[model samples]
Each structure stands twice: as structure tokens, then as C-alpha cells.
Target: MNFVEELRWRGMLHDIMPGTEEELNKHMTSGYIGFDPTADSLHVGHLTQIMTLIHFQRAGHKPVALVGGATGMVGDPSGKSAERNLLSEDVLNHNVKCLEDQLKKFLDFNSGPNSAEMVNNYDWFKNFTFLDFIRDVGKHLTVNYMMAKDSVKKRLEGETGMSFTEFSYQLVQGYDFYYLWKEKNCQVQMGGSDQWGNIVTGTELIRRKAAGNAFAITTQLIKKADGTKFGKTESGAVWLDPAKTSPYKFYQFWLNTTDSDAKSWIRIFTLKSQAEIEELEKEHDLAPHLRILQKALAEEITVRTHSFDALQTALKTSDFLFGNGSLEFLNSLSKEDVLEVFEGLPQFTISKDEFSAGINATDLLAEKTTVFPSKGEARKMISGGGVSINKEKIADPALILNTENLINGKFLVAQKGKKNYFLIMAE
Candidate 1:
């Protein structure tokens, strides 16, 4: 597939350097994308650029995943509203290792001569003295040119404003490119549209220092149709690490994509080619309820970033909850499976003595439980038949709480309304 043209057509290519396509056609060339190692796991925001490299490699070129181990400690001032605290070396090292592990899942690090390689900027920057940094790499870009970037411009707009450390981020990042250009013969750098300023600085640094050629490419910053930033859930960022975000929630996140978003996202986020995506879009238009585009997007991303087995488990769990499966079928799930499926839901704990002491449903809903803040409100809901236990509707306020209603022998699934679910675990 023609990677550049494909990205352009799908609205993924936000910027590309002159002669970039010609350079790609010449021979096996190397391109790099820098990833911030500020977090232990990558979020969907990082996925867009990672997918860019994946597509580059598929087009018979080399891809380099640069861990921003050095830049992350100082924090990039370009996009933030406030200055960030620097991370300790121990934390930064740990985060870099974690981010490396996630990037390996998207790109082939062991295939072909153009195999993906992970490099940490800290390796080269660790012992480089401040004096040498200014004299060597930092001297290429003047403050006037650095201040022109939109990232720096926006930060300067804010009341808290920017810091010198953040102002120096682009120069530090530029050195990574110069380092790669001199050491590894790497040419192109790609990232979200926001990275244009920093990337062009890299190219400029190479021009002044090494007198070498380099290119820049950027993908469209993934944004929601309503203008909200993508990659965020109500809880926070949708992390690749299951510890921060569960596999079940992750699958659901994709499955919940909107009709308009699924159209573009299906192509950008998935390995499905132009023809396959078109067919899925046609099928979705034929019956949007089935959401062929969403399913394809979810399935491809789920299996790729996660695994077929995790996808299956998440799908099975989703079906049991939202599909034709009944409460009995939900009860049939293992305690572990049930917990995993509903992990994103709110939870509470109550003691066995509190549950067995002839406490009425209203008391259980408020005092004995933690769903509502007051017993009077719980009574009103139960009397309105708007309360449920294990999905069975409840109308009586005097109903007793006992082992009979508990799932897994010590827990009760309570719902105040159609959408509110509270898990009360009695020990």
C-alpha cells in the first residue's frame, strides 16, 4: 500500500516535508516518532503516531520508536496549562521500560531488515554536560525562532505562563533527531500535528550541525466530532496497561464510538485496507444498527493491541451484560469473570452482620449500603419500583437482605435506576 497517499486520503497526514515521498521511493529509509515516557502505559493519544510508524514499516521502510526519556523529565511546555514537576530517575527509567513494552505490540521489532528499533534519548543525553549542550545542539535555534511555535505560543498565553525548562524542550528534542541522523542515518520524524514545531526544529538542527537531510511528517490530531479531545474516558485516559484501564473497559471504549467517528476511525486505527473499510462502511450504511464499522474497528484494535483471547473474553462479557443474555446467565459467570466485566462500575462493601441483621431494603440501600446518602431517598426509589437486585425489579421497602439474594454467597448487585449500578461486597 502507498503509505503517504493512504494517510493523505484518510485525513491522517497533517503535514509532510518536501520530497518525502521521493525519499521513501529511493531506498529503505528510517523514520522516527518520539513517545513521552511520562506515564507507565501509553494512551490512545499515543496510538495515532504509533500506527503511523506501523504503516511506514508496512511500506518497506524502517521505523524507530524514540522513547522521550530525557525530554519527559523536564516536561514539554508546548501543550500544558501548568509547569510539571520533574520525575525522579527511578520513575523515568521505569516509565521508559513500560512504554517500550507497549510500542513493541504495534510494530515488528524482529521482522525483515527494516525491523523496528527502540532507542532511549537518555542513553545519549545522560552524561552530556550543560555547557556542551548549549554550545553544540542548543546554538542552532535562536529564542525568536523557538518562541514562534504554536505550542510555546499557547503556553505563553496562559496566566501561569511557561517555564525556561519547557521553553528549551524543542531544542532538546531536536538533538534526538541530530543524534539519530549522525549515528543511525535516520531521516524522517513523525508525530501528532502538535509536534510540527519541534520536528521542524530537528530538521533545522540537522541542517546547521550535521549538514544532513531529514524530513518531517505529522498525522491529524485525533479529535472527537463534538470538538472534545479524543483518547480520554470519564475515568481518565484509556491506558494500554490493564492495571490502569481494564481490557473489558478498553473494548467497550471502541465499541462505543459514534456513527460519524467510526467512519474515519475504522481506517486510521485498524489494519483494514481501503477496500475492506469501504465495504464495512457500505455495510454499516446498509444497517447502521449492527455498526459494522465499529465492530471492525473494535475487533482489529482489540486483537492487535490486546489479543484474540482478550477480545473474545471482553466480547463474551459484553454480550452477557448488554445482549440477549439474561440475569441468570450473568449469575452463571465465575466471580472473577463478573468482577472483570463490571470492574468500571462503582463498588462498596458491607459486613455480614449488617446485611443479616433483618435490615430492610431501604436501610440496606442507605445506611447498610452506600448507594444513596439517605434512607428517605432509598425508600422513595424502592417504593417507585426503580430499584433492583441482581437485575430483578424491587417495589417493597420491607424486603429483607440475606444470603438468598447475594451472588457468590456474599455480594449483592444493586441498581438505583436503569443506569446506576452499585456492587456491595459483604465480608
Candidate 2:
């Protein structure tokens, strides 16, 4: 497999330095992409680059994942209007560790000749003093050259203005490339389109510092078809960490993509071959309402990011909430998992004493909780077969609910209709 061609077909190729493909084609070269530890978990925004590295390894090259522990502290000014608040060394260390662990799940580290390797820039920069960096590295690139870069130029034009710390980020990042090229024999650096300028800085640094030839490749920055930001929802970023964004929510995020976005994202994000994708596209077109493309994209990505078990749980959660899934599925979940399934739905709490003593359905829905506005409304809805408790229809408005009705021993799942749901918790 040709790495560059793989990215090209996926619409992931943004900019490539000349001869990068030829260099990659000549032999199994070492390549790397730097991931800044701005957050503990990588969001969907980072997946394009991750996919780039995955293709790189599949093409029989060594892949290096560089966690920007050193550069993260300084903060890259690329695509940012203002300087960022720096994380403490301790926090940065924790983030770097987390990022490393996450990256491990995606790439094979034990594969023989061309195994994936993780590196931290902090290892080299920690002991290197400011005087050492400026004298040895800073002199190679002139101030004019640095200011000419779009990232620096944009900040210079902005009202907030760039800081010395951020301005020197490219130099730090460049040094990282030069160091990797010299020590690890890593011949290529890849990233998002925004990193084109910074990536070139690395190539230039290698050229001037060691008279060595290095290459750069950048993938397209993902964007939604509607022009809204990708990887974000009403809650915020869709994180890879299951703790931050539950597996069910993460699955739903991809499952809910617009048709046009799913059509494009499937190519960029999934490892499905061109033939398989074409077939899926055909199947999707046959029944657009079924959301076949979105389901395929969501399931593969969710399973890869989390696990097959997690994907099953997410699917079961979806079925329970949206389809005719059984109570056994809900009963199987832990308290945390149950809460995760009910996230973003309306919830109310009633005393355990009152719940144990048994309350009438109308009273429970109207007085004890706000599932209904009033007893009359609750009775009307119940009598009309519009209300359900624990997945069973409430046949009579006066039906008594007690400890026996509590799911997982502490909660009742109330459905106002086919769609709206409420969680009534016994405190």
C-alpha cells in the first residue's frame, strides 16, 4: 500500500512536500506525527492524523507518535487567535501519559521491523537550557522567516497579539523534528493542514542544521458539510475517553451524522476499502431513511475507539431508548451504565420511604415527580396508553408502584410517549 496514495484516495491529503512520496516509496522510512497534549483525551479532530499514521504503518514504514509534552507547555499558536493558558508540569505529565496510553490502542507496537513507537519531546528538551536552544537552534531561522509563517502572521495581525512563548513554538517543534531525524532516522513528519507552516519549519531545520533531507505530509482538517465544527456537539467535544464521553454517547455522535457528512467521513475515518465503501454507499442509497452509512461508520469507529463490548452496550442502549429493547438489557447494566444511558433525559427524585410505601401511578408522575404536570394529565395519558413504567404500559391510572417497580433497585424508567423518557430515582 502506498501511504500517500492511501491518504489521497481518502481525501485526507492536504499538502505534501515534494519528493515525500518518492521517499516513502523508495524504502520503509520512519515517519511521525506530533500530538499536543492540550487535553487528556484525543477528540475526533485528531483522528485524521491518527488515520494517516495507521496508513503509514500499513504501508510498511515505522510510525512514531510524538506526544508534545514540551511544546504543549509553550502552546502552539497555530490556528489560535490568542495565547493559551499553560498547563503545569504535573498536569502536562499526566496528559502525556494518558495520550500515550490512548495511542497504544490504535497502533501495533509489537510488530517486528516497522513497529509503532511513542516518544515524548520533553525527554530531549527538559535538560536543554534556553541559552542552548537559542544559540544552537534559534540562529538557523531568521526573525523575518519566522514572522512570514501564516500562524505567526495571523497572530501578529490579531488584536491580542502572540506571545514570545507561542512564537517560539515552531522552533521547539522544529527541533523535535531535527532531533528525531538525527537520532531515530525518522524521515517524515505528518499533521493537519494547519501545521503546514510548522512542519516545513522542521524540514527546513533538518536541511540547515544537519544538511539532511526530511519530508512533510499533512492531512485535511475535518469539517462538517454544514460548515459547523466537526467533533463537537451540544455537550462539547466528543472524546475518545469513555469516562469523559460515555461509549453510548460517543457511538451516538457518529450515528447521528448528517448524510452528506457521513458520506465523506466514512472514507476518512474508517479502514473500509474503496470497494466495501462503494457497496455500503449503494446500500445506503437504497434506503436513506435506515441510515446504513452512518451506522457502518459509527459501529466501526466506536468499536475501534472503545471495544466490541462497548459497541454492543451502546447498541443495546439505543435499542432500549429508541426501539423495542427489553427490560433484561436495562437490568443487566451497572448503576453507572444505567445513568449513562439516561444522560441528557429528564430526571426526578422521590424519597425511598415514599417509593417503598407504594404510590399511585398518577401521584408518582404528578405530585412526587414532574413526569406529568398534574394528576389529571397523568391519568389521561395513562388511560390513553401513552404512559409506560419500566417498559410496560400503565393500564390503570391508580396502579400502585412500589419497590417491585424500581429497576436495578433504585430507579423507574418512565416513558411519556414513544420518544420522551424520564428517570425517576429513589433517594
Candidate 3:
């Protein structure tokens, strides 16, 4: 597979230094992309770079994933309006380990000749003294050259102004490339287009310091068709970690994408072939309401980011909440999973003793919980066959709900109509 051609067809290629494609075509070259350990978990915003590395490895080249432990402490000023709060060494260490674990899920580290490798910038920077860094790296790049970077110039123009720590981040990042080139024979650096300046600085460092040739390639920064940020929702960023963002929510995030974004994102995020994607697009066009494209994108990405079982659970969860799915699925869930399934719904707690003794359906929905505004409304809804408990219709307003109705021995799922849901917890 041609690496540059793959990126280009997927609309991922943004900028490529001269001869980058020619160099890649000549032989299996090693390249690296730096990931900052600012968070314990990588969000969907980082998927572009992750996909880049995946493609790099798929093209039979060595892919080096550089986790920025030392540089993370200084914080990159690129695309930032203010200086970030620096994390402690311990926190940065934890984040780096977490990132490594996540990256392993997508890249093969055991393949011979062109396997992926993980590196920490701190491994080299930890022993190098500040004086040594200044003399060896700092002296190579002039202040004018560093200041010429868009990342630096924008910060200098910002209201808060840039800090010295952030100001020197390009130099630190540039040195990372130099060290990798010298030690690991990594020839190329890849990242989002915003990092073009930092990446060029690295190539320039290799030239000035060792007279070595290096290359740079950057992918497009993804954004929504509406011009808002990608990977963000009403709740927050959709994270790769299931603990931070539930598999169900993660699935919904992709499944709910606009038709336009889904068409573009499927190419960039999934490993589906061009022919297969074109087929899916034809089917989607025939039935836009079916959201064929969105489902394909969501299913492929969710299973890759998580697991097949997780995708199944997310599908069942969606059905249970939105369609006529069974209670058996809910019964199989843990307490935490159950809560996650009903995460933004209204919830109310009732006494365990009261629930054991049994409460009238109208009373349960009205006085005990706010599923209804009043008993009259609850009775009205129940009489109209618009209320359900545990996926069963309430036949009579005076129907009794006891401990037997509890799902997983602690909760009741309530539905006001076809859509609105509520959680009744017995404690």
C-alpha cells in the first residue's frame, strides 16, 4: 500500500514536505508522531493521529509512537489560548502508561521487521540537564527561527501572552525528532496540520545539527460540517476509555453523526476499503432515513475502539431505550452498567420496605416518583396505555408494583410514553 496515496484518498493528507512521498516509496522508513499525555485517556479528538500511525504500520513501515512525558510538563502552545496547568511527574507517568496501553489496541508491536514501537521523550530528557539541553539543542535554533513558528507567533499575539516554558516547547519537540532520528533512525514526523511548524523545526534541527535529511507530513484537523468542534457532545468529549465514556454513549456519538460528516468520517476513521465504502454510500443514498452509513461507521469504530461484546451491549441498550427490546437484556447488566444505560434520565429513590410491601401503579408513578406530575395524570396516562414499568404495560391504574418488579434486584425502569424514560431506585 502506498502510504501517502492512502492518506490522500481518505482526505487525511494535509501537508507533505518535498520528497516525503518519494522517500517513503523507496523503502520501509521509520516515522514518529508525538502524543501529549495531558489526559489519562485519549479522546476522539486524537483519533486522526492514531489512524495515521495505523495507516503507517499497515503500509509496512516502522511506526514509532512518542508519548510526551517531559514535553507534556511544559505543555504545547499550539492551538492553545493560555498556559495549561502542568501535571506532576507521577501523573504524567500514569498518563503515559495509559496512552501506551490504548495505542497497543490499534497497532501491532510484535510484527517482524516493521513492528510498531512506543517511546517516551522523558526517557531521553530525564537525564539531560537544562544546561546540556540549551547547549546541544537550544543553541541550534535561533530565537528568530523559533519565533517564526505560527504556534509561537500566535501565543505572543494572544491576550495572556505565552510563557517561557510553552515558548520553548517547539525546541523540546524538535529535539525529540532529532534524538529519534539519530538513535532510532526515524526519518519522518507526522501530526495534525497545526503541528507543521514544530515538525519543520525538527527537520531543520536534523539538518543543522547532523546534516541529516528528515521529512514531515501532516493530516487535516477534523471538524464538524457545521463548523463546530468534532468529538464533542452535550455531555463532553467522547473518550476512548469506557470508564470515562460508556460504550453505549460512545456508540451513540458516532451513530448520531450528520449524514455529511458520516460520509467523510467513515473514510478517515475506519479501515473499510474504498470499494466497500462506495457501496455503503450507494445504499445510504437509496435510504437516507435508514442511516446505513452512520450504522456502518458506528459499528466498525465501536468494535475497534472497544470490543464486539461491547458493540452488542450498546446495540441492545439502544434497542431497550428506543425500541421494543426485552427486559432480559437489562437483567444481565451490572448496577453500574444499568445506570450508564439510563445516564441522563430522571431518577427517583423509594424506600426498600415500601417497595417490598407494594405500591399502587398511580401512586408509584406520581407520589413516590416524579414520573408524573400528579396521581390524576399518572392514572390518565396509565388508563390510556401510555405508561409502562419494566417494559410491561400498566393494565390498571391501581396495579401493584412490588419487589418482584425490581430489575437486577434494585431498580425499576419506567416509561412515560414511547420515548421519555425514568429510573426508580429502591434503597
Estimate TM-scores for all models.
Answer: 0.91, 0.98, 0.97
Q: Write the per-residue lDDT of candidate 2 for residues 1-427, one digit (tens) a residue.
A: 5888899988999999999999989999999999999899898898888888888999999999999999999999999988899999999999999999999999999999999999999999999999999999999999998999999999999899988999999999999999999999999999999999999999999999889999999888999998999998998998999989999999999999999999999999899999999999999999999999999999999988999999999999999999999999988988888889998889888888998899999998899889888889999999999999998898799999999899888899999999999998898
TM-score of 1: 0.91
Candidate 1: lDDT over CA atoms?
0.85
Among residues 3 or more apart in sequence or in different chains, the pairs in candidate 1 whose N, CA or C atoms overlap within 3 Å are none
Q: What are the Cα lDDT values of the candidates?
A: 0.85, 0.93, 0.94
**Candidate 2 lDDT score relative to the true structure:** 0.93
lDDT tens per residue, model 1, 272-298: 878888888889999999978888888
| Best-matching candidate per lDDT | 3
Sort order, lDDT high to low: 3, 2, 1
Off by over 4 Å in 3: none
Model 1 misplaced regions, further than 4 Å: 326-337, 354-362, 370-387, 393-398
- Angstrom error of the Cα, residue 103, model 3: value is 0.7
Per-residue C-alpha lDDT of model 3 across residues 272-306, encoded as one tens digit per residue: 99999999999999999999999999999999999
